[model samples]
Target: MTTINYISAVTQALEEEMERDEGVFVLGEDVGARGGVFRATEGLYERFGEERVLDTPLAESAIAGVGIGAAMYGMRPVAEMQFADFIFPAVNQIVSEAAKIRYRSNNDWEVPLTIRAPYGGGIHGALYHSQSVEAMFSSIPGLKVVIPSTPYDVKGLLKAAIRDNDPVLFFEHKKAYRLIKGEVPEGDDYTVPIGKADVKREGDDVTVITYGLCVHFALQAAEKLQEEGISTHILDLRTIYPMDRTGVVEAARRTGKVLLVTEDTKEGSVLNEAAAAIAEECLFDLDSPIERLAAPDVPAMPYAPPLEKTFMMNEDKVESAIRELAHF
Candidate 1:
């Protein structure tokens, strides 16, 4: 096993995939030379060369459209959005074309494209650079949304995303690039299957369900709460769209208490869908009402430090929520 940071795991996954498959290529703004806006693609250009590691114009739509076209022709294209906030321009291309290609074509075409974007807050990236975009695309039928919380899963899920025979939106928390690290198996084909929730920590008093950076925050909060006799069962919804209903239901049933945490706004967030599932499947088993702790319903995250802290959810907030829910 090798211990690596989140960003290095991303670089490792890209390098391994490109080396493993000849058809796998990467394209996005500043991906080739600049090594991605966050350096997630650093050193890949030098190793893979220009043809395989492409740097396209700053056009998100074109990036998705071109990747979709390549995927249709049997090439696996990984398209990167400089920031999750700037992915709006590519929504039409991703949602309409890449998502519906296989279904619309009646299984005649397969868009094996993976879109990678750094998401979530905590680095003071503020409104423009920091945002959780998984919620927007998670409800879309054909697009699989994945948000990995650890270095190990980052490598595995990304490889799985590239190999998937459909469009996948893989969101990495910029906050966790270096902050989160874990031991990953140092070998090939270390891919974690999508659509499954991971049990990060197991407890019986209350269940904290979340994804992305929130998973790390909740785990920290769980440790603090354990001293107070509140044992939290943490579930990381690694893939939001094709949610692990079985896992969500099982976790909810185990504790009889649920607290959904996320960095996105409370309204129409991923937790809302999760809350519905718990209510539908494990309503009778729940001891308390499903509670949620998330960012405020502001237009966007504020740039000011004070305002950003207020808008962002953290370990303290998670612990407080878990403590309260455990008492309920």
Candidate 2:
């Protein structure tokens, strides 16, 4: 076991996967020579050489396009979008081409591609850089959206994403890269299966459903609520799209209250889907109305620290919401 930060865990996954499979290679602007904007790809270029660690032009569409092409031709390509907000330029290729190729061809071709991006707020990335984009892609079929909160989940799910026979959108919360650290397996064969949710904290009072950096906040809120005799169960939905419906229903059944949290804006957020599932399957199990904690329907993340703090999701907000639901 190794105690590493989220960024190092990501680097370890890339390195181990590249070493395990000759077909796996990484490409993006500054990834090769600059070790990526966040240094998640640090030292990979020197170890893997230029051919495997490619540096492409400042084009998100081209990067995604080439990655899809490479995957279609039997190569496992991990492409990086400098920031999750910038990935919009490549949405055409991602949603239209890579996502539909396998189904459109009737299992004839598979796009074994992993698109990684640093997402969410708390690093002062402002409007242009800080955006929770999981909701945008989670609605698309044939694509897996993964947002891992811990080092262990990040490394394992990333490796699993790379090995999967379909395109996976892996979002690493920018704030969690260095903030979140935990023990990850040292073995090369370890993998956390995709489409499964882990119950971080087992409780009976209320169930908190969340992902990404918000999972950490939910844990913190759970700990605080535990002090007041309110047991909070946290369900970390590691894979967003192929969501763990069973996990969602079970958690809601275990507890009578449900609190859905996400960093994405409230309008058309991923939490909406989770809440809907709970409403449909576990409505009888719920004692109170389902509560959702998320950013307001704002145009973009504010630049001012005060406004951004309000826009961002935090433990205080989560704790307050849980407390309210517990009483209701």
> What are the RMSD figures for all models against the true structure?
0.8, 0.8
Encode model 1's per-residue lDDT on 233-275: one tens digit a residue.
9999999998999999999999999999999999999888889
Q: Where in model 2 is the C-alpha error above 4 Å?
A: none
Question: Global CA lDDT of candidate 1, please?
Answer: 0.93
What are the lDDT figures for the candidates, one per model? 0.93, 0.94
Q: What TM-score goes with each of the models?
A: 0.99, 0.99
Largest lDDT belongs to which candidate?
Answer: 2
For candidate 2, what is the lDDT? Answer: 0.94
Q: For residues 57-82, what per-residue lDDT tens digits would candidate 2 score against the true structure?
A: 98999999999999999999999999
